[model samples]
Target: SSDVVAGYLDAKWNWSTLVGKVNSSTWKAHSVLSTTDATKNNLVGVFYNPTTTTKGNKVFLLAGSLGELNRSGVQRKRENLGLKLVVGDVREPTGSEPSGRIDWAEPTSPLNESTKTAHQGNLTEFLAAGGSGVLTEDGTLVFPLMAENGNGDVYSMMIYSTDNGSNWALSEYMTFAKCYNPRITEWEGSLLMIVDCENGQRVYESRDKGRTWTEAFGKLLGVWAKPRLVFWDVSLHLD
Candidate 1:
């Protein structure tokens, strides 16, 4: 297994990250990703919470970053956040690298101009839902995401890639406003999403990659109930 960590950097006004391999007893971590890298020059270096998922020998890392724009002599950040995908190839332990290593390729922005136009500019402040992503049985890479609209209302959705990592797209469907912090996974042939709503935690399942979502009544315990003074949110996953 492998692990990743992200921390804020005061100097760069952004964040830095480290990746490591989890052995049975020890975790050998390596300093691989940094916001200061020239590859992220166009951005403001504010790479936020990162989520990861593995497929075959490839590891995909997704993070949210603010756009950088120069206004006269001052640099300003964009109102809406953008998502970036960084891919790495896992390597076995070698002579110089005893703990093995991941060679991370340059970051790519999946939400390109065409993608934004396709969405009709309805989503703003779109960011990755921190935690782990899911790989479906059909080999689709799915990651949970939270987005805000013009009214500043937040909702949960998904971003997915069908042709491996060659291309990516955002889900057409989304949870109701104010329902955020989504935890998603694939069960059987459906994608299940557990989100904390205004009333309480609710379960939603989508059969068609995220074109639509339906509330899954009685699918998970402790869901669809009224919130209490002290209660823990339920998360869904398949062993």
Candidate 2:
């Protein structure tokens, strides 16, 4: 069953964490996120996206939930989007526990009121891009995020933490409307993001910690060469 690390039902609409033991080739499942909490049930937890990344000996797990919250058995209409993050500490295996262990801290709502306030009320929802985030050489943790502008336009941006996950801040700049699913990485002290926009796929570069992003047209030479020739913008230099 190694091929099948884990599986769940679509009807449940709940997302959980499942870890595999490297030593034994075994798997363990944990329900770190729940949709049935009456206290917070107001926000329906589709738990749509789940992402993970590692920094030193710590592992970070992030997930996003959305939908209307139900209170008093009544489904209230509102934007109940949220992002949750959990940190885990690594420990060596012992005689009692051969597979080692990860001590996970309680999940925190990273995308809270502060996040909305920081965005200046431009975005109505935020979701984690489902995949691994990038850890820069300078030790900054960056994660790609998709957001909806209340007007139904989706934009790709980033949420990053410089102090080793102590606090995270949303990117002040975002891609043009209708761009999403940003994939980010560190290149020469700058963050590069590959995103799919309404017209086509484009690359962007951010040097100021996501504060600003500009089109990276020079990086992919081969891809841009043909387009430039079609427009006759530059002298073609054959390599």
Give candidate 2 misplaced runs (Cα > 4 Å): 1-25, 37-44, 67-79, 219-239
| lDDT for model 1 | 0.72
For candidate 1, report its TM-score. 0.75
How high is the lDDT of residue 20 in model 2? 24
As a whole number from 0 to 100, the lDDT of residue 187 in candidate 1 is 76
lDDT per residue as tens, model 1, 1-239: 11234321122222222222222244434444454541243554456667888899788999876545535577575533477788988778788754446778877777776775577438756877777899999999999999888888888899999998898888998898998778888877899988888887778899998898888876465455346586644452221
Q: Tell me the TM-score of each prediction against the true structure.
A: 0.75, 0.73
List the pairs of residues colliding in candidate 2. Answer: 42-69
- Model 2, range 1-239, lDDT digits (tens) per residue? 01101221122233342222222344455565555421254454456567777898887877776556556666576554578787878777789864556777777877667667768538888877876688988888888889887798888888889899998889898988887778777888889887777665678899998888888878564223122324443443211
Alpha-carbon lDDT, every model: 0.72, 0.70
User: What CA RMSD would you report for each candidate?
Assistant: 8.1, 9.1
